[model samples]
Target: MALFGFIGAGNMGLPLMKAAAATFGKNEVIFTDASKERSQFVSDQTGIRFLTDNCSVVKQCKNLVLAVKPQFFPVVLNEIKDVVTKDQIVISIAAGIKIESIKSMLSNSVRIVRAMPNTPAMVLQGMSGICFSEDTFTDEEKEIIDRFFKSFGKYEVFDERLMNAVVCANGSSPAYVYMFIEALADSVVSYGIPRDKAYELAAQTVLGSAALVLETGEHPGKLKDQVCSPGGTTIAAVKALEEYGFRNAIMKATDACYKKCEELSNK
Candidate 1:
């Protein structure tokens, strides 16, 4: 079994640990966190070994997952920089932290895989964007990482330059989708639908629509056209949305998210 270690045990890290432990079993995992309580709690909950320090986890596991927030990344890197070695494969989920930045912070000899996984991973329905330098990973190593990511949700390997857009489209889109759901539910509630049932209906509709897009591989507009008859309810609602600037609103929101990602990287 391959040993895996997580350096942060918060929301994002905890889910990954849970999913990983379910696949590889708890014995193959180890972790450390800034919060000793959270570290102990997650270890107890998942039956993984918990260490008191970052270096301790680095020493025990060859596959290291850097799950700390971007703001704390440098500090964490400094803590384990001396202990990280060439054989250790470091997978970083810290958004906007470039692979080159991590390489410079640590030793250039260490293998690194940069990944952007969205909030959906918390619910095990994540879409992750993975990119690594061509020479940094062997076929077996790549397979292992791919398997681990798929165990949680979907994974796509893309050119590193597009990672930021992936952040906008997948990583940050969840919040926008949630907002859309909330607005839809609210509108129905105004029409006398029970608030709770309205939420369920709205959310499930979005879920089903997304599934249709994926399973059928049809253009979304074509799918929408199917729902809307020559002179029907769906088109009327869609027209209203267009009048309300729905497309423009979504584009602006994603653009803002993309800009924020760049800002984070600069910081």
Candidate 2:
């Protein structure tokens, strides 16, 4: 059997196909996309193979990754449910699709992993969160899937209830971070820095700051304090950010994102 099979080869799916190929080799990976040209593009880019249809992928592969967008899950699940076997592991990277919802379409006997992965995965720095249908996977199966995710970036397994929180935290937060970088670069440009240099400086600062948090395991507050010395420019900037309600704005944004995830789950 092929090691990894993808149901769609769009932006997120394409990178994941590459990661699976990196982990298991190209010959063991296969996929199918809605557009034949898209499927062919992925094949040419990664040297992976593609079949003509989703059920063909289900028949051939052991671990099936349903990488289609959330709206298409119902149709795609209906198409493959009949052909998917109990021995196959079906993993989904679509945001806001619940395990119970999938179990209703496919049988409870079918193994399902619901996951959310961000766009940074295109550059191999993606973070993913997963939740399994109860008692559905062996420890060995879990290990291989974990390795598959780590081939692109890091991953964490969470309780299914917290999966929406994962949506707001990492899955959608990159857009906010990118907006912050753009605003910071604009401010730098207003201060006479070249626009290209300003963007590079702002983006690198954000990247390094995130790296510090991940690498040091120190509280972000402590790191911020380190930068804001007594009567320093950093402290002055911090005071301005607080005055503008930066933290509150982020909290509100996350709350909205969480509510939207809940809405998607219900639909």
Best by TM-score: 2
Cα lDDT tens digits for candidate 1, 113-148: 889888788788999998985455778777778878
- RMSD of every candidate to native, in Å, equals 1.4, 1.1
Q: Score candidate 2 by TM-score against the native.
A: 0.97
Per the 3 Å backbone cut-off, how many clashing residue pairs does candidate 2 have? Answer: 0
| Cα-lDDT of candidate 1 | 0.87
Estimate, for each residue in 143-244, the C-alpha lDDT of model 2 and write its tens digit. 888889998898998999999999999999999999999999999899899999999999999999999999999999999999999999999999999999
Clashes of each: 0, 0
Per-candidate TM-score against the hidden true structure: 0.96, 0.97
Candidate 2, lDDT over the whole model = 0.92
Looking at candidate 2, what is the lDDT of residue 63? 96
What lDDT does the true structure give each of the candidates? 0.87, 0.92
